[model samples]
Target: MKRFFPIVFTLLYMLAMLKPVLPVFDYVINQDYIAEYLCINKDKPEMHCDGKCYLMQMLEEQNNEKKQNLPAIDLKEYPIGFVTLINLPSETTTTTPQKNHNNYHNQYRFLTSEQHFHPPIFS
Candidate 1:
């Protein structure tokens, strides 16, 4: 009984030390956190794009100018097909639906399924 008591106590102590090493599988990085990390303004997220958008706009303008300079090609005169204009969605619109606070929490809850099968290891 004395030996068993020491064994049990050692086991409990090891478990206590290992408890903190367990990974929090439900932990998730949020968009707000990303924004904060990137030092982006919450009110004007467009500012996150910085001058990239402006540069793209300038390139598009140049492309348009080149297209205008080219001689007009009539589709009826040639058998080959030609693309006139490509319509793309505005950058201001988000393709993916925004996740609300509840949705974000729900996503994190679902992410814990992996933890049930394969628990994460913390270093």
Candidate 2:
């Protein structure tokens, strides 16, 4: 099911990208219907606009909608805030040496713990 979701999403994304072409295909296939009912220059047949005006209007409307959906920002008018950096001194620690023991079992005691078994986050 997880793999199927990506395939379906990719197909859908491709289909959405081809949305503009669908209008041209519709204009080619249904030219007669568009000219008869949807054309703006239906009265002026001398210009030879066989539903081309309707197609242009549809394309222009789509373009306008795309333009409207974009976020408007004016960076020139607004002043940006200044960034400041600070440095801090880190503390040093000294370790004391421990006495060595001859117990081999103590070394393997924490080997099975979850913290050591898990991978390091920094890596």
Candidate 3:
């Protein structure tokens, strides 16, 4: 009984950590936190990229596209018209500029009094 305490506690701690209620079977069993998402061929025994693996081929295609690329895009080709701005709910009724309130500074303002400072600004 005396020697069994350490072993029992260790087992209980491990069991509590596993948290089988949540989906962590992949991390617990397979030791992988995230499941692989890369496309894998079912028929092939080894990784055999039909063409994609070559870096040079991809770069060449990109360069060729850049050479034939148009100077500017035509908005007519797109189904939706170009939108510059979006209107949302606003609170203010008047277009007039708001006056400065000195409530926080005890009614003393540097800019309003036409005062300027050099470097080491805080001092």
Top model by TM-score, which number? 2
lDDT of each: 0.56, 0.87, 0.52
Off by over 4 Å in 3: 20-22, 26-123
Task: Go through the candidates in order and give the clash count of each.
Answer: 0, 0, 0
Model 2 misplaced stretches (Cα beyond 4 Å): 77-123
Q: Mind giving the per-residue lDDT tens digits that candidate 1 earns over 1-123?
A: 879999999999998776543322111233344435533344577567533344454456656876998999887898655656789987895588776766344444434454446677899
Instruction: Predict model 1's lDDT versus the native.
Output: 0.56
Q: Pick the candidate with the highest lDDT.
A: 2
Report clash pairs, candidate 2.
none
Preferred candidate (lDDT higher): 1 or 3: 1
Q: State every prediction's TM-score relative to the real structure.
A: 0.25, 0.58, 0.19
Tens-digit lDDT string for candidate 2 (1-116)? 98999999999999999997888999999999999999999899899999999999889988998899998988876656654555778888888898897666755444455554
Better of 2 and 3 by TM-score: 2
**Tens digit of lDDT per residue, candidate 3, span 45-116?**
366532222333445665676678847777678756566678888878777887988567576555565566
Candidate 2 RMSD to the correct structure: 17.7
